[model samples]
Target chain A: MIRLVPRSDTPALLQVATPVMAVLATMIAGGILFAIMGYDPVAAIKTIFWDPLFGLAASYSRPQLLVKAAPLILIASGLAVGFRAGIWNIGAEGQYIIGAITGAAVALAAYPAPEMWIFPAMVIAGAAGGWAWGMIPALLRNWFGASEILVSLMLVYVAQRIAAWMAFGPMRNPEGFGMPGSRNLQQYPAASNPELIAGTGAHWGVVAAAAAVLATWFLMSRHIRGFHIRAAGTAPRAARFAGVRPETLVAFCLGLSGALAGMAGLFEVAGPAGQITDKVGVGYGFTAIIVAFLGRLHPVGILLAGLLLALTYIGGELAQLTMNLPAATVQVFQGMLLFFLLGFDLLTRYRIARRVTA
Target chain B: MIDPIALFLLLLSASTPILFAALGELVVERAGVLNLGVEGMMIMGALSGFATAHYSGNAFLGFAAAALAGALVALPFAILTQFLMSNQVASGLALTLFGLGLAALFGKPVEGVKAPTMAAGPLGLNWIVWLGLAMVPAIWWFLNRSRAGLILRGVGENHDAAHALGYDVRQVRLAAIAFGGAMAGVGGAFISIATVLQWTEGMTAGAGWIALAIVVFSNWTAPGVLAGAWLFGGVTVLQLRLQAAGVRVPVQLLSMAPYLATIIVLVAISARQKFSRRAGGAAPGSLGQDFHALR
Candidate 1:
């Protein structure tokens, strides 16, 4: 028999190492999974992990990593802040969709006019759209005491429907003979979020992502608001005694995450994705939850975790192209990463001991 | 005018999945374990049930396989939360993500495959629907009359008190979680084998989450779960019919009806509870809390 003894103080070092260990464990498990599916395990793992970064097609795949990581990093950074305050804003996907729709609406409304201020105005609209969408749950929770988790998640389905409606009815590109998507923003010069440097894939979204990282790090470490968030999560009664209003905290966290997710969506539409479509929500909001936890809810950790997840996306595609692996193989690998992370986290708080036999 | 019997039958079938999952979750919550991975377990069951039924040419066996598959998937969550004492919400979410991915991987080969045909039971309804309906009273009796049910509730209400009274809290919770998993699996199987009759990626969609909401909507009662599931089912069928009717509104907008209705119901329930000064009625005292045995 074995027993788990509670730790007086959680080992900080172990908490940090668990994510790294989780990644390695995921790779091994992914290898075994691939082998069971009748593929060469080592080759499959190498294709997913190594080939995207330094393999023969690295030049093509490396740029895609930044393109993918920007939105993930930006969205994850925003999500981590709320997560720290015990706010589960899992409806980032909805905010992202609304942002893309609102942003695209601005661009299309000003079609054929290359105005200097149009793009900036669109960005603001995108942020506001996401913010308002997120506020529904926040306001509901504050006023009616509803569960934010369920309300926010329900909004995702609603948002998906809204997006589909926009694509089919309002946002359809007139020039494309009634196809179901807005005008490709890439072709529009003033509104396009093009790569600043050739072949680097560094667009306006990448800049925003980097800025978000620095800003989040500073806010978490240096701001009094951050203190309130931590205090609320760790000790709610203490936070209340210290004058942290629960309603305000809930609104701010949910609204801030929504705005960031919206910006990410706007950037994605104007840059990589190129247009607002029916299927715009590709699970970034959902995946960012995993990224937030995988990063240990730290800004810098989120940045790195975003890159690691982005690597899997690139590698998963590469494996699909090189081998006959299913496209969802990456999703399974990501899911495994979270499981291992959660499982390994047990080590930080508890010590396993053998039961003495009498 | 719609045929009342046909509409009721559609509502029954539509609500059956949510009913099964919500009732299962009702028990889990009563036992003070919140398993958020119902979506994952449901999807896993859908694929496994469909695959087994397709291979064996037997729908009942397929459902059995689904139950086993769901319970098997939930074992890791039980171990992690019960023994290891990890964060319940995070572990449950991870379980969902993992279950979805694993189902996708395992289901890749069986995509679009037709399930074995199911035979009708009493009242011309599928056997699963009857099972779902019967479970309502059965669960009501289990929670209200049975000794084990009383012990489970005792454990959920206060693990410390239960422990002091010599009941195995961990064992009771683990059993509850496994039962929830099995029910969720059957719920998922009902979708693929009974309703859609074909496996697709992410087919359970957000039914699991809705079921979670239904537990709260029902105030954690077996009867309330039944009511919530039917209301949700009615909204779903209405939306589909509206979309089919093409009544000027966009199909997308019509599709949002069920989700929007769910939010509205939740808001109304919460608002009533707040205004009436009843702070958290019928909620399991230890729901969503981690339980660890200290020596």
Candidate 2:
């Protein structure tokens, strides 16, 4: 009989390999699912995993990957920082929506203009919008001792309503004859987040995401503040002794995450999504939680995990279209990846054993 | 002259799922475990319940199936965190994600299918609603009037002390977790069989999260869970009535009522907890902490 006990003292290599193993497990499981659906499993798997970057459709899908991965990496990196500090800010979706609304508000206010300052102003507004939204939970947890998780999650619904109000009320496109959305940012070149490189799908958001990863790496590795955040999470008593104020850390981490998520929302609205609408959230905020975890809450891990998640998302869509699967299949797949990664993560910390009864 | 009877009945049906989920989580936490995966378990229960009802055409069978499904999903959680000493918060989150993904995957085919109609057995009220009401007293009795309940509460209060007294802390917690999963499952079934009467993706829609908050807001009491659920149900029913009445409120704002109410309730409860040191003051000593027994 094969025992399922985890080995004692998992080595560093196993720490790194578990996520990889989980990914492999998901592929095998997903391939089986495809086969059960009567699609050619190999072809379906190849299309989802291989085609986006290497197959006949690489040229088109490759750019889309960067476009999709950019916001995820940016948001996930910010969230990973907070997660490391043991600060749970689950409302990034709310921050993302608020950012888009704020950023787009700036552009919409400046519509029909060709000013060079419009986009930069929108970026600042985006970050500020997210930061302000994030502060709600931070302040509540600080003052009222409310649960930040609930507060942040509740804010998502509030933000969604606010977004709907914007699309239907103030920001409604007058030219579209009463549609519930704002003017397409693409139409206003000044506000549009145009691809930095003509065909590479590189946008200002991608650049920001890259910068965020590098900056976070330095902060986490070399900065005193980063050390404080880590210490607070690992041992609150010790961190307090080291002069790390829990309240301040909570506010700072929550604010920083909100800003990044908000920036992601702003870039998405101005670049890919192209308008402020009710669907601006698209569950990215919640998905970023998974991205943060899959990335092991590390800056570098977040980068790779963000791309991997983005791949699954693109592949899930591909499988849906080509194999007659439902759109929700991707959500299920993403959820499974998080599930397996977390389950496998147990091996890193504890070993399982069975004892015989006397 | 007011039709208090109909208003009261409407409140009961709406509050059933919250009541079930809150009570279940209250039990889990009372045993010193904080399982944030209530939402995921509820969703799994909803899907499994719907699928079973669709196939078996029996609401009772569906509820039973949902309970089983919930317990099965929660078993790994019990094993991993309770036995292996994994981080409780992280493991609970994993259970939720896993349950959600598995539910979605399994629920794929059941999408768009209507649940079998749950009949009002002898009282003009859906049977599930009645069962939900009954569960309140049952949970109360279990916690205050039974030996197992004492052991469960004992384990939650201090696992080390309980273990020293020769009580099986891990066993008690494992049972509580399974029981919590079963209740969450029943709550999910209530959504399908009694509330929506249909299977839709993400239909639970933060109900489980609200239930978690309700556990906190209720200050870990059974009657408090019922009251909180009714408050939520009242908000939901009012919103639906306003929408039907064509009050011209933004539908988005109307839909956000329950979530907003949850935050308000959370604030009210947390404030009360902070201020009232003499009354209803203490929290479970071992709440959210893992219990490890070194052999």
Candidate 3:
């Protein structure tokens, strides 16, 4: 018989080591999966993990890393705050879509105009749009006692449909022979989010992501609200007694995450994606969930985790081109990482012992 | 000029997947576990079932394979939540991602392949649809009248008390989760084998998520799931009819109706529970909490 006994204190070493262990385990499992699928497992692994950094195309791919990681880091930073407070806003994807649409709506309405204020104004509108969409579930949870998890997720589908409608209906580009997407925002100098430096791939969104990490770190470690969030997560009754209202926290977390996710969407629409289309949401919001967990719900950890996940994305694309690896392989790697992390988390909380039969 | 009987039959076929998936989830939730991986399981079932039917040329056997695949896939979640004492919500999400990715990886082989059709049953309905229709009463009777179900409900309501009473909470929950997986698998197979008759990547789409919403709208009852499924089915059939008849409504907007309806129904039910003094329609007490039997 096996017995699991609870540990009184978790060692800090184990906390750091477990995520590392999970990553290593996923590599081994992913390699085995590749082998089973008749691919050259070692070469596939190298193509995915090593080639993106040190391969012949490293210089070009290295800069692209920041472009990919920017949205993920930005979104995960916000999600970590809510997750720490035991509030789940899993519908960041929906908020992202709405944010992009609203943000782009500003530009589309002011099309062919060279206004200096369009970009910043679009940012605020985008945030408000996401905040409003997020408030639906938050308010529902606060007043009606609905599960925010389900509500938030259901809204994702709704948001996707809305995006499709916009692409084909109101937002469709007029001049380009009836293509089902808004005008490319990149061509609009006043509204476009351009790269700050020449070859570094650093856009305004990257700067925002850096700011979010620092801000989140400050909020979590140095603020009373951070203390309240941790308290609420660990012990709800005690936090309530200490005068932290659950409703207010719910609204704050959901609204804050929604706004951040919305900003990420705006930045993407104005920069990399360049237009609001039916396929604007390419699973960044969902991927950020894994990023948040893999980062241990911490800011600095999230920064690093976002970069690592970004590496996987770029490398996965490289592998697909060179080694003919399936696109789904990267997704499987991410899922396995989370699973292994969750499974190994048990080691931090409990001691496994074998029972001696009498 | 539309035939009501044909529409009704379309509704029956359209709703079978959600019915099976929701009914399965109802049982799992009743036993105090929330496996949020229904979407993953369903997609897995759709792929594996379609692939098997394509290769083996036996649609019934494909369903068996799907049921097995679903239960097997669910085992990881069971281990994570039940044995490892992991957080159920996070674990369930992980299961969903993992299942979807794995299915997509394997599903590449069977893409665009046609699924073999099974023999039709009475009224030109598929046997699986009939089986799903029959499950409502069987599950209702099982939950309300059977001794085993009483024990299962006992475990869900209060695991510690049930444990004290010497009922193995872990065993009961494990069984419930496996049964839920099997049902979801069959539901997914019904989509690929009977309805679409073709394999496509991510073909189940959000049917599994819809099933999850339906379970909530059902108030955790078997018969309620049937009604919820029919509501969704009716909306789907009506939208297709409208689209076919060249109605000017945007197809995307039309597709949004069922999800919007689900949200409204969820909010309404939740409001009722919150405002009412009795609070009679409560979820299973330990629904999302993990159980660790430490003696």
Write down the TM-score of every candidate: 0.98, 0.93, 0.98
Candidate 3 local lDDT, A147-194, one digit each (tens): 788888888999999999999999999986998999999999989999
Proportion of native contacts kept per candidate = 0.77, 0.43, 0.72
DockQ, each predicted model: 0.79, 0.47, 0.78
Pairs that clash in candidate 2: none
Two-way lDDT contest, 2 vs 3, winner: 3
Q: Write the per-residue lDDT of candidate 2 for residues A87-175, one digit (tens) a residue.
A: 88888999999999999999999887898999999999999999999998998888777888889988988899899888888889999
Interface RMSD of the candidates, in order = 1.1, 2.7, 1.0
Show pairs that collide, candidate 3.
Answer: none
Model 1 residue runs over 4 Å out of place are A353-358
Better of 1 and 2 by TM-score: 1
Candidate 3 C-alpha lDDT tens digits along B61-176: 99999998888889989999888988888888888888889998888888887888689999999999999999999999999899999999989888988999999999999999
Instruction: Give the CAPRI class of candidate 3.
Output: medium
lDDT of 2 by residue, B1-295 (tens): 4367777788888888888888999999999999988888999999999999989999899999999988888987888677556567767776776777678777878888888877686458888888888888999899889998888899988989999999988888889899999999999989987789988877888888899999988888898899899999899888887887788777877888999999888887887887776543456778888776664
Q: List runs of model 3 lying over 4 Å from the truth.
A: A354-358
Per-residue alpha-carbon lDDT of model 1 for B1-295, expressed as tens digits? 8888888889999999999999999999999998989999999999999999999999999999999999899998998889778788888888898899899888978887788878899778999999999999999999999999999999988888888899999999999999999999999999999999999999998999999999989988899999999999999988888877779888888878888888999999888777775677678898888877674
Winner of 2 and 3 under DockQ: 3
